[model samples]
Target: SQQGEEDPQALSIQEGENATMNCSYKTSINNLQWYRQNSGRGLVHLILIRSNEREKHSGRLRVTLDTSKKSSSLLITASRAADTASYFCATDDIYNQGGKLIFGQGTELSVKP
Candidate 1:
């Protein structure tokens, strides 16, 4: 079963603007992570927030998690053309032995220069 589901299926913005994306999950997770992918390449981990943590930040990326609501949000500040990519949220199944990450549908972002 799919765990994460992202909102705003696609986003378009100008360089320097802020971009925000959201994800909602269905089950209890050990940890939630956000990743970015450019074109058809591999995903690069942006940030990971544990179930005990509410918020986390790294560079221009900020993430907030609400376990009570089973949701998470990602914010990208000072967006640039290079920020154009597909953003996905993943959740680690608490019941899985291998700690597999179930990915979201993803939000495709287009930052125009």
Candidate 2:
């Protein structure tokens, strides 16, 4: 079962704009984490908000979680071209052995200068 699915597989915007992405999951989770991947590099942890938490902010990023609906949202305020990268959502499912993380296909964000 898929844990997360991000809307708008791809997005293009100018620098200094806001980007929003949504994710929906099938099962309950302990925590949901968002990550940013640059080109071909590994995923870098952006933020982790627990299921009990409603929202979290890190630098220019804001994330919201609604466990009732099994969904989450990510907001990037004042985006920059440097922020251009693929964003993924991962869920920490308690049922899996060793707690595997299921990632979304990802939203490819392109921030133009």
Candidate 3:
């Protein structure tokens, strides 16, 4: 399966700081998306950038893609305790005739007050 994998498994940061995570995947994809899950909450779409794009940003969240290396990166600026949650990357092959998403193991983020 063409699934993305997040590194560091876990991360801890202070409030007002920045949090960064990395994701790598196998196979080619039409686009990649980042989602956030807050503890018991469901995953919420953070952002999505197509393969043709190099970088994208939403509010405090920034995402970058490098298709050549089959990797992507996420950066969250001005982190807060509320930012404590899990971050995951999902790969979608929109042009694969069928729309399917492959999710990663996710990185647990912890923000301190």
Best by TM-score: 1
Q: After superposition, how far is residue 19 of candidate 3 from its true place, in Å?
A: 0.6
- Candidate 3 on 9-96: residue-level lDDT in tens? 9999899999999999887889999999997689999999899999999999999999999999999999989889999999986556
Descending-lDDT candidate ranking:
1, 2, 3
How would you encode candidate 2's per-residue C-alpha lDDT over 1-113 as one tens digit per residue? 66589998999998989999888888878889999999979999999998889999999999999999899999999999899999999998767634789999899999999
Better of 2 and 3 by TM-score: 2
In order of listing, the candidates' clash counts read 0, 0, 0
lDDT of 2: 0.91
After superposing candidate 3 on the true structure, give the runs of residues whose Cα lies further than 4 Å from its correct spot: 94-98
- Tell me how far the alpha carbon of residue 7 in candidate 1 is from the true structure, in angstroms, after superposition: 0.7
In candidate 1, what are the lDDT values of residues 14-43, reduced to their tens digit? 999999999999988889999999998999
lDDT of predicted model 1: 0.94
What lDDT does model 3 reach?
A: 0.90
